[model samples]
Target: MGYSVVKMKIGNSLEEDIRRIEAALEVVPSGKNLAVDANGRLDLETAIEYAKALEKYDLFWYEEAGDPLDFEIQAELAKHYKNPMATGENLFSMQDVRNLIRYGGMRKDIDYLQFDCALSYGLVEYLRTLKMLEEYGWSSRRCIPHGGHQMSLNIAAGLKLGGNESYPGIFEPFGGFADNIAVVDGYVGLPDIPGVGFETKAELMKVLRSVAE
Candidate 1:
């Protein structure tokens, strides 16, 4: 299930991540989409070095090459890198997504457009984001929804995005509401169950929130 362009953090050093990547590669079979998210942890030079080191890994995209706002820098990185690039979750609006795609020097440097619409906006904003992307000629584009996992998958499938992102951080104990998610074969399959198809553990939230109150 490592296909469909999934990313995992490698932290500061490439040595360990390289080994980890090797181990993962063994089980990944072949022809699965894959990538990495550095979380902007490395300097440009370091990021470049690391990217080169993992060149054999053939990452699908690298996240946050630098700052999200620094389109110039990201574009520069993209120019040098072999794989595609993606970024979001730090941006606050659809305009940010548009600007990245329309970046002056690096317009369209972004291969995949990643954006998030929180639940507060409900379905309206979610649909709005989709409409906006379509209006901008991104109808054939791939967008990774930020806040809504299942919702994002639905949108991705409908819009024919590269694929939706997994909500849980790779190592987090809370494996998100959808544990059945798989990245294999370069595609995502939505659950057939009704609604979002995720069963939230009601008591789990209460247990965690008890310490807050």
Candidate 2:
């Protein structure tokens, strides 16, 4: 209930999505961030139209309007829209992410990078990606990794990342923060237990302990 940012999924139907987004906006209250994710499913024209229609909402950020790897379309969308845009969840390598920056037409001023640690060959590569971003003048605050798990939580705290995504009550035993950790003012403290702290999440640790034994 202390959440300040809400991200919704879109790119299904233009009319329905617009209606749904408007409905979400009505209840989101002012001063709160309302973001949306299209999951890179829309075509160029539809993505453009949706972006145009979405502009009036003052969204916190619009995410993955078209194919995740299609930088050309993103560049085109950037020309017509000025709102903050986010992508890179599907990009699995640092090289592709670099290409997105060099040629994807992403504006650092208002765009976000969602390079997940697990999805991109784990934390080692994620660290490399962050370093790459720094060379290009991007800050670690611009990143919010794609996965919601204990490992990412530890990494977020250890590296001072912008944030980690979360899916509350989903993926039992593997997709949440540490057990008993409170979400204070939209934030939760990481566990101090060793090795990603799986032991702190009771249900998850039961399964993990079995694997270890």
Candidate 3:
């Protein structure tokens, strides 16, 4: 995969996670970035501990260290960790996102936001969220939607988002972008077709057609 950033899941155990991160760093080529996702599995103490322990690696971001809605945990972690952090994949509404921005202690300068339009509501709501971020002095470039699907890809391209997450060789027909567009040097071009470009993925298009029929 020509991705510049690779993300992995953590929060299993401090020691185990450290070992795994070291092992992953060994294989990932130089100049590439690695991100870790805990999926909101850690407590405040453990999340801070992990943040301290993993700070040397200079990870692209630590994701969802505690319950997604817990602003205190996130705020406390931010005081201890200076590196970039990411969350909001599970945040479904603009109001929830507003709360995160207000109380989550997320630094707009360094942190990234992963609000997936598909998971939240739709493009309309996502547009509103983007507007909200703008109002708060945040840039649209900090957003990288969570879903590894074409809908988010289209949104990323159209809205100039930071980047879109991708899952190659996973989730079968539904998790990737257009078949003809190849990722090169960690960047990929969007499909030329109109709409969200779902029809450009032959396998996914087949599945969609079957469901409709």
Per-residue lDDT tens digits for candidate 2, residues 32-110, read 3788999988888998898889888889888999998889998899987788899998997879899999988888877
lDDT of 1: 0.60
Q: Which ten residues in a row have the lowest lDDT in candidate 1?
A: 170-179
The candidate maximizing TM-score is 3
| Pairs of colliding residues, candidate 2 | none
Question: How big is the RMSD of model 2?
Answer: 1.5
Identify the runs in model 2 with alpha carbons over 4 angstroms from their true place: none
Number of the top-ranking candidate, with lDDT as the measure = 3
List TM-scores for all candidates, in order: 0.68, 0.94, 0.96
Query: lDDT of each structure?
Result: 0.60, 0.84, 0.91
Q: How would you encode candidate 1's per-residue C-alpha lDDT over 1-213 as one tens digit per residue?
A: 344444567756788888877776665553135577777677777777776776666667667756678777676776566666667657655566567666713334346666654431545665666666677666546666644355556656655665566655532333333455565565556676565533332444465577678
Between candidates 2 and 3, name the one with more favorable lDDT.
3
Q: Residue pairs in steric clash, candidate 3?
A: none
**Which stretches of candidate 1 lie above 4 Å from their native place?**
1-6, 30-32, 104-110, 119-122, 146-148, 155-160, 167-195, 198-213
Model 2: lDDT of residue 84: 87
Q: Any runs in candidate 3 off by more than 4 Å, and if so which?
A: 30-32
TM-score of 1: 0.68
- Evaluate model 2: give its lDDT: 0.84
